[model samples]
Target: MMLKRVAVIGAGAAGLCAAKHVLSRLNRFAPPVRVGTYANGRPIHSSMYRDLRTNLPKEVMMFPDFPFDSRLNSFLPHHEVQRYLESYCQSHAIRPHIRFNTAVDSVRPVEGEEKTTTWQMTSSDSSGRQKTETFDAVFAKCHSSLSLSPSLSLSLSIGEVLHSHSYRYAEPYAGQTVVVLGAKASGLDISIELVKVGAKVTLSHRLPRITYPLPAGIQQSSPVVAVEDDGRLRFQDGSVSAADLGLEIQDHVMTPLYHFLTPPAFPSLFFIGICKMVCPFPNFNVQVQFCLAVLDGSVALPSRGQMEEEVRRELQEKLARGVEHRHLHMMQLEQWDYCDALARLGGFTPLPPVIRSLYEEVWRQRGVHPQKYRDLNYQLVSDARWEALN
Candidate 1:
């Protein structure tokens, strides 16, 4: 069958990477796959606000063949990464396929039992004219977090309880006592970044422990307890500072649960860039591991329970050996990152059963089975693999 035109939703790392993979192998296609790119915003790689440098190094974050400019060091700033994405697209000749400022309105299967799907897209042009377009099959490149509509409001002041989405430059929050709510990588990174810039930062979450990066450059360390959460954050039973972070984790935990419990409410988009995997062997290898999973089909769109089970199996084997297990953390983080990147970029959530099953079928057919299908013998967030999962 002739491959229909594929529409890639987001222009972020994974979306671009997926596009790159397709473009790289375009010549192999018999019908010549036509690719089109669409995104809500003009090209904000993950909506990276100010003070956001790649958590992973340039070497790891960069595409395999195309390296970052030699002059720039490892940690490329957010803008630099955006610039790199632009360059990557240019160097790979992906610009012609991209459409900026376009948004996908709705996507549903075409009526009647047909293999083809229809994407009814509504977008506006520079002239303020609205237009609708259709595509055969679309890659919902948006992130998964978008599924949990920002509608859920908490008792915490609306101004105070902001999902990582509302966050941008720290300038507005310079002197005010700020409480960053999240236990995930983005929460941790944003909190640290805020603290670095002289903001009294408190990361509020339920996770009893956190894997902290030490001063000696040791990637791993014993779990640290966060004390002083009323707006201030004290670590490892250290002295308390002013303004403690709120320790309310119920909402945080409930967010993911809500997503799972209410499928219709919570879009099952992939979440990526959760954390950087630190193997003493190489370094921050999150992006590298992500690319591998994508290419291997171990991780892909439309997450399925079986596919997730397969992923868990691989985690068991990799995590079995403390050092080797670092790869598992890397892969897991990439999975989360992909979810987020896809939703933000694609403007659609995979929604369980459909998208997840799609990923399962694709991964299974691609020989991306779990390394080991048995139950995990040990816990994932343990001491041994801490460094590997930095």
Candidate 2:
């Protein structure tokens, strides 16, 4: 039998890390169905929007093993982040393996002799060329979210409800009143954009009233209660609104991943960078390493039933504490512990303490100085501490 290797088709930071380790150890590991990349070639469904800047600082968000360029500011615009990604790809020699301009059609499992499973992957390229290949295992690199951004099948009946993920620009929403959900990161940014385009926006969330000054066209409302017909919205504080459009936004990519990564039914299939309210790149870096550890059998996973039970218990605990069902993925505070546990279980170096210090600091500063928090810079003084710069 010939040994097969994993071909990381996506060039995201997480994918690159997976490739990096896989390339280093050819003999160790490789298996799958529905394992994919950022396929479908639907650039329009991308979550990026014009005029968007990263909510996370570069110091905390950079891949744990790969650092961002030192010259860039702590806070970065979307273009700068893209440039950093390009630089990382070049530095790590990751672009060559990625089949750009191609879309994955389907990945189905084929049962071989002895009950062994292999994945049959089908994909199409830019010229509409199609090909099929087999692999022992798979990695799902697809851009997934509970929101409509990546799930092409999901549709909201309310014609007025819009997904902020598909909003590339604000001009199209001009003169319309939009009610935005989840005032953490994307929601506020989109609200700002809508206000600039002469659209009235009601920024709704469960957090305490934001103290920062906002445009007259934008009003910060209490937590949302219900989505009524005719674009009417109710708030937990008992205020009602009739907005022209409805939308939702949050801090990170929304994906339905099991606790500590990997699906319950298919442990052979790996998923990286699915957790929300996390420091994206750092989370990806840790997750990819942990997945590799599991693949190599260094860290054993619980039985499928046990894994599902843990997920259920985690969700029920959150619900008991009154966590809104929609916000279950928001693991902002739990991220530190989650990453630490993965590192311990995988026998890998944990993220530098400075990362957490700076992340929490930025979170605090963001609420108090939403307008000017990005203006402040910070330098990592050591593995344990970060100091602010003027």
Candidate 3:
């Protein structure tokens, strides 16, 4: 059987990585497959901010086969990571497969009696030109929606509101009181950045107040309860703050995934980079290889019923253990095990020990000093070793 074509959605790190892997291993499959990528923006619309730097160091953040420039800092700015991705695509000959400024409309299964089914994708470019194409499989690497709790919904006229998605810099909110919702990484980072530029920032979340020492202009608040008609922000603990702007850090919730890959009902469709708190580039590398293995008949999946049942069981176990549904896919300390499982299942090499050690060290550093962690430097000495260069 010939697996003639594959479609990858999004042009970000995950999509580019998938395209590179598919193109490189075309000879492994019975028949060579052609891959194409669809991106919604011209230069790529990633959720990167102007002052953002990667929390994970470049040592473990790179694809296993393609290392970042050795002279680059361990913690690189967002543009450097973007440039690394561009370089990866160019080096792997993936540029020819990319279709920029094209947004995917829908992907659905083409139903038939065959055991292995095909997929149909509809996409439209900026010019409003639409095209429908069919392929043996589809990989969706697009960004998911931010999970906003229902209690925090406010009227449109309340005040200036924005998701972290639209946040660029801190100068715009200088001298104004800003309430940032969701105290995740972005929430903490943005709050710190805002305070550096004179924004009175309040970081609010449902979780326990963080014990870290914040900058002078920044304060911690209880989770936001409601927005009053007078533009005051009410907190769960009955505190109120005069709000001029609101920024919501997008939270990701697992969407009933099977092994964090595909929905059992649609085996031909897959998603990458949905898991949180993992080394993204390395994770994408393993996931793409495993997905390709499944496609080329190298790995056999269980029946649809079995796959769906397993997903339910996993979610139930997590909920029983006090894990929220929204955090089901968060692989903070579990990332190493998860990556090893994918490698074992796909017949690929497991994550190197050096990567795991560096990842754990960085995780500890972030907790110890969230504000100053990135000041540390690192060097990779071998597959199983790394050194902290202070």
TM-score sort, best first: 3, 2, 1
- TM for candidate 3 is 0.93
- Clashing residue pairs in all predictions, respectively, total 39, 3, 0
Best candidate according to lDDT: 3
Query: Which portions of model 2 miss their true places by more than 4 Å?
Result: 1-4, 7-11, 27-43, 113-115, 142-146, 149-161, 206-208, 222-240, 250-258
Q: How accurate locally, in lDDT, is each candidate? A: 0.42, 0.72, 0.80
> RMSD in angstroms, candidate 2?
4.0
Better of 1 and 2 by lDDT: 2
Model 3 C-alpha RMSD to native: 2.6
Best to worst by lDDT, what's the order?
3, 2, 1
- Which prediction has more favorable TM-score, 2 or 3? 3
Question: What TM-score against the true fold does each predicted structure earn?
Answer: 0.53, 0.85, 0.93
lDDT for predicted candidate 3 compared with the true structure: 0.80
By summed lDDT, the worst window of 10 consecutive residues in model 2 runs over 149-158
* Residue-level lDDT tens digits of model 3 in 1-390: 454478888767888888888887776532222333444353334467799999999998999889999988899998898899889989988887787667777877888676667888888777778888878888877343233433466666556887787788999989888889888888889999999889898898878777867779888888888888877888999988887888887566655577798888887688988888788889988988999988878889899999989989988988899988767888788888888998999998988989989999998899889888998889999999999887
